[model samples]
Target: MPLGQRPGDKSDARYCGVEVLDFPAGEDLPAVLNHSLASAFDFILVPLVDPNYRPAPGSVLPVSASDLILGPAQWSNHVVGKISEWIDLDSEDERLRLDSELTLKQEIAWASHVSLQACVLPAPRRSFCGNYARVVNQILQGLTNMHLWLRLPLEKSEPMDDDLDKIKNNSHTSEIVDSWELWNSFRLLCDHSSQLCVALDILSTLPSINSLARWFGEPVRAAILQTEAFLTNAKGYPCLSKRHQSLLTGFFKHSVQVIISGRSNHNVFPVSEGVLSGDESYAEDSRVRHALTPYLEYIAYLYRKMDPLPEQERIEINYRDFLQSPLQPLMDNLEAQTYETFEKDVVKYTQYRRAVAKALVDRVADDAVSTTRTVLMVVGAGRGPLVRASLQAAEETGRKLKVYAVEKILTLLLLFIV
Candidate 1:
């Protein structure tokens, strides 16, 4: 049952705010209730009027009623944009599934003006048409303009039910390639947003899980994009093999999300216990299963990693950071030749040089009075990328720039000049 309602109350949802938002007992109560984010709701799902039920609101979400669904499991009140899939739109055109303009209009016309945080589509993973790339590009544009998020499926077999029923094929192949391809696609969209996340249904068996769990190379993992995907169907959580469960458990322990589906009015967890109550108290009892069965199960035993405070940085310290300090040690007796060798061998030096040039260019662009030509001196111009970037920036901002490229080994400098 919902938290504050009586046993016979018709409006069954507890955190939905339909009752309060629609028919508040008092005026100040709504403000008082939603004031402290520490006690706010996730999202307030509203009804869409007739003739335009599947309206999309894009990023014009309500400030008081909604906040960005931060870390999924770690919110005070977690509400997301909701559209009733059960509603009969009376149209056979499934073009909304992959049509970018259709998608955009739906998003912009969202009846509730809710930010389209993460859109849930009907099994676009298993069968996207020829227009998927364009659809993805359209979404990528929204990410920058309004910080929209898309919840593309990793694998889906639901739509195959009609054909499968004729042949009665309940079996599934390990869509490992699909997961990899789709994951890679989401990652390749260029990180305008913080992370490129896909929402994967959790009903699949271990082979697919293992494929995804195996280490993606460091360069791929360390790309500007973050692969912070989410998992759904916590009801299927116990189905994973112990090893695969451990793998998912470890991932969610970091700032990841798990969404559970259940009846609207069922008691998921105690209102007093807090939103993400994955703690030690319920480990040995039926309470954990019972709670999770209703979207309230937080198996803290499975996820042992601690989340840092909002004020603190995410402390993902690795062993390499221990060996190599950020501040390079200046050996008192260092030779210039040794320094030159080290500089030449450093793979990141080129990138660092380009970044420095970009920063200098940005700084010069910001300055109003310093109109004299900005002299960019690349100390170790091993390759010409830094010089090119400087020239490009100067051109873009209509600023005068003079480049001075210096290399200790004149052979490298001369070779480049030639």
Candidate 2:
């Protein structure tokens, strides 16, 4: 039950004490094998060959050809060093150099055989352990037969098959098998299996079905069905409980429906008559409704969750009051003469006001240069003619004036401003 124990470790009942093997340097190792055996008390605890270590020719044992094929190249020197130390090796650099050379030649031969054998083997059989082991051992045997070793100590008494058989029949046995199957099938279903593993691993760690669905893929529904079948038939293994299985299945089914609905071209208003009428029955079908329900519910849930924030209200202003505000009174006082004239001579008011405004403009412009002026005004200005005249006069006189002008008759003033 301890983590890192090999799958076969629990099968034996006779508790043979653990042994630690040491490979010493500079003694003809093969000649000194008897001494090593004697030290083991006839129970040899062979150390795992550090994958980095290259074994002596005679020490090599036969292994599956497929297993012997070099795996992915390890680019890290630190990892190579650790492996070297574990195998009682001299240096990682030396081992790596030798491995690279040997692997190139061995891989070519392995590849040729693998290609030929692949053609002969059935798809399912190619995935089987027996076939895989045969291919793996061929490459390993070619490299060095000494890589294989028994890790467990040998029993002084003869081993019995019955106890081993009983252990093989235990509840955890199929779990061990399933783990192996899952690991071996990994590359074949990389996209799907990896995604499923990530989703399940995350769910195991965080227990959130909703978050898990975010990463679940298109094949999730099919995978869940397959997983359910495996759990049902997998005797003696602690697979997912029925309740968990049902929940996972329901979740995947719901997710699939949600995705389908999201990708569907259902519209509130169909552009063409044929478009809406073509699949009316399909749209109203019970199956379609069932599939879309979860998606609709989820959307509604999100909408409800976001409906409580405060909203801004725009302030409304009245133009009539704005025109008569405090700023307007100052403007009106500056143009009081124009207002007084307009109220008096209503008929000839426009022409008389134009002349008065022009004169006022001239006076303001002349005075602008004589003082640091704060305000300049043109009174009795008709249609703002005096304002234009004042600006022209100020330009010619080389003076800076802050000009404000008023025109008699509201219509004329509006026209002038526009």
The TM-score leader among the candidates is 1
| Per-residue accuracy of model 1 over 1-418 as CA lDDT, tens digit each | 1223222222212222211112112222233233212232233322121223333556332222222323333222333333223322222455444233453445434522343343333223333333443444555555532222234333323334455555545454432235445545545544423433444444334344445453222112110101122234455333334654564544442323444432223343453221222222322322223322323222232333323222212222222112444432232333455445444433355565456557666666566526657777877665555566667666656667788998666556765778
| Per-residue lDDT of candidate 2, residues 154-254 (tens digit) | 01122257655766777333212222233335324332221121111111112234533443332221111111122212333223444444444444322
Candidate 2 regions exceeding 4 Å error are 1-22, 28-40, 45-137, 140-418
TM-score of each: 0.38, 0.16
**Residue 8 error, candidate 1, Å:** 45
Count of backbone collisions within predicted model 1? 13
What is each predicted model's overall lDDT from 0 to 1? 0.37, 0.30
Q: What is the lDDT of residue 305 in candidate 2?
A: 35
lDDT (Cα) of model 1: 0.37
